[model samples]
Each structure stands twice: as C-alpha cells, then as structure tokens.
Target: MQYLHAAISETLRLYPPDTKACRVDDIMPDGTEYSPERWLEYGTCRQENPFRFPVFHAGPRMCLGKDMAYVQMKSIAASVIERFEMNVVAKDTCPGICPR
Candidate 1:
C-alpha cells in the first residue's frame, strides 16, 4: 500500500497537473528523477510537507478533498492493476509538458 502511494506521489511529481512555478528554490533533491523510494523511509510512506509538494495546493487554500482523493486514487489504481496487465508501448519516449 505504501509503495502504491509512493508511486502515485512520484507520478504526480513527474507530471503535475498545473505547472505554475511558485518562486521557491527547488527543494526536491534530484527533482527531475522519477524515484518513488524518496517518499519511503523504513518501509513506510513519509508525509510530505504541503508547501514542498503542493499537488493539492497548500495552507488555508488547500483542497478539502485531498484525503478522499488519495483514497479514491489508490482504490482505482489497485482495482485496475488487479484486473489488467499494463504495458508501456513506448518505453523510449518521454513525456514532455506543453506550455499553455
């Protein structure tokens, strides 16, 4: 379960929905690398600081459904993984963010 959560976090970090830069120095070590292990410590997922990993926004304006969203994502991901075998057709191709 923790690995699943970490994978999701890594996925989000690699491909954030909104690319709006906040002026903060890159606090993430090896920010460009996709490493789920960074979120794990002693076989558990570590809670990230919202300001550093603001996928759900932060502070007073943080998304109210953040917990529910994680639950839903984990459920869906588990269900899909259990029912199907997925394969990346283009392993050599890397995804790039398009500017709006």
Candidate 2:
C-alpha cells in the first residue's frame, strides 16, 4: 500500500495534471527520473509539501476531492494489476501513435 502511494506520487511529480496552468520546477536531485523510492521513507509514503508537489493544487485553493481521487486511482490500479500481467514488448523503441 505504501509503495503504491509512493508510485502514484512519483507519477504525479513527473507528469502533473495542471502542467499548463502551473509551472512546477523539479527540485529533487533526480527529478526527471521515475523513482517511487524517492517518496518513501522508512517503508512509508512521506507527506509531501503542497507547495513543492501541487498536483491537487496548494493551500486554500486545493482540490476538495484529492483524497477521494487517490482512493479511486489506487483501487483501479490494484484491480488491474491483480487481474492482468503487464510486460514491456519493446525495450529500446519509443511508442508512437500509428494512424489507422
């Protein structure tokens, strides 16, 4: 559960929802890298500073459904992981849209 939360946090950090609305500069040492362990401390998801990681916005203007959104995301992710096996088909190639 902690790892899952950490993974989600890392994902949001790299690709925030409000990328266009707000510009958040990556401050972490390996900010551009996908690292779930960065969010975890002593095997738990550390509470992030809203100002630094404003995925749900910060302070009073923050989103009200933030907690609910996390719950829904985790639930769906868990369900999918439990039911299916995911594999990387191509290691070196970048995936691109193919026109039909």
Candidate 3:
C-alpha cells in the first residue's frame, strides 16, 4: 500500500488541512504541483518552516499532538482499507496531466 499512502499524502498536500497559511518563505515556486516525494526531503521539508504550514504551528507554538494526529490518521486509513475495498473508476482518471 505504498502507492496508496503516497496518493493520500499527495491529496493532503494539494488540499492542506490549513489553507490559510501565511508563508514566511517560498522555497517552492508558486503554482508548483503537489508532490509527495517533497515531503520526504530533508532540510527542505515544509515543516522546516512552520509558517509554510500552520496546521501544526511552529517553533515554541508547535502542536504537541501533531505526531499523534498523524498516527491516528494512518490508523484510521489502514482500518478502513482493511475492512472496505476501494476502487478508482477509469472515467475519473486524467491522463498525462501529472508528472510521473
């Protein structure tokens, strides 16, 4: 389910839990597509600059439940997938629109 995890992460990135971020810096150029791999990057991760993602806040204001939140999300996703089968319809697929 590595692909599934990546897809879910990409969804979160494209539609972040917090949409009203006041960016402190723009390491990524404007309009860049959401990429799950970028989340795995060291030093350059968005969490490095809390203002880039205010959902968990940053610095002294960082959320103590951030890690637990992720754990809960993953657990729920895994539980749901385990109990239910999900399928993507071909009609919903867009070809060549996303970089591979």
Top of the candidates by TM-score: 2
- Please write out the lDDT profile of model 2 over residues 19-52, one tens digit for every residue: 3643765476655678788887767678799999
- Tell me which residue pairs clash in candidate 1: none
Give lDDT for model 3.
Answer: 0.60
Per-residue lDDT of 1-100 in model 1, one digit per residue for the tens? 8888989998987777787766975656555778888888766789899999999999999999988988998999988888987788898664332123
Candidate 1 residue-wise lDDT at 44:
77
User: Where does model 1 exceed 4 Å of error?
Assistant: 19-31, 85-100
Q: Enumerate clash totals for all models, in the order shown.
A: 0, 0, 0
| C-alpha lDDT (0 to 100) for residue 82 of candidate 1 | 84
Q: Return the top candidate by lDDT.
A: 1
Compared to the true structure, candidate 1 yields what TM-score? Answer: 0.69
- Order the candidates by TM-score, highest first — what do you get? 2, 1, 3
Candidates sorted on lDDT, descending: 1, 2, 3
Extract clashing residue pairs from model 3.
Answer: none
Residue ranges of candidate 2 with Cα displaced over 4 Å? 19-31, 85-100
lDDT of 3 by residue, 10-94 (tens): 6665666875665684456667676665554332223335667565777898889977776777788888878977776796664
TM-score for each model: 0.69, 0.71, 0.49
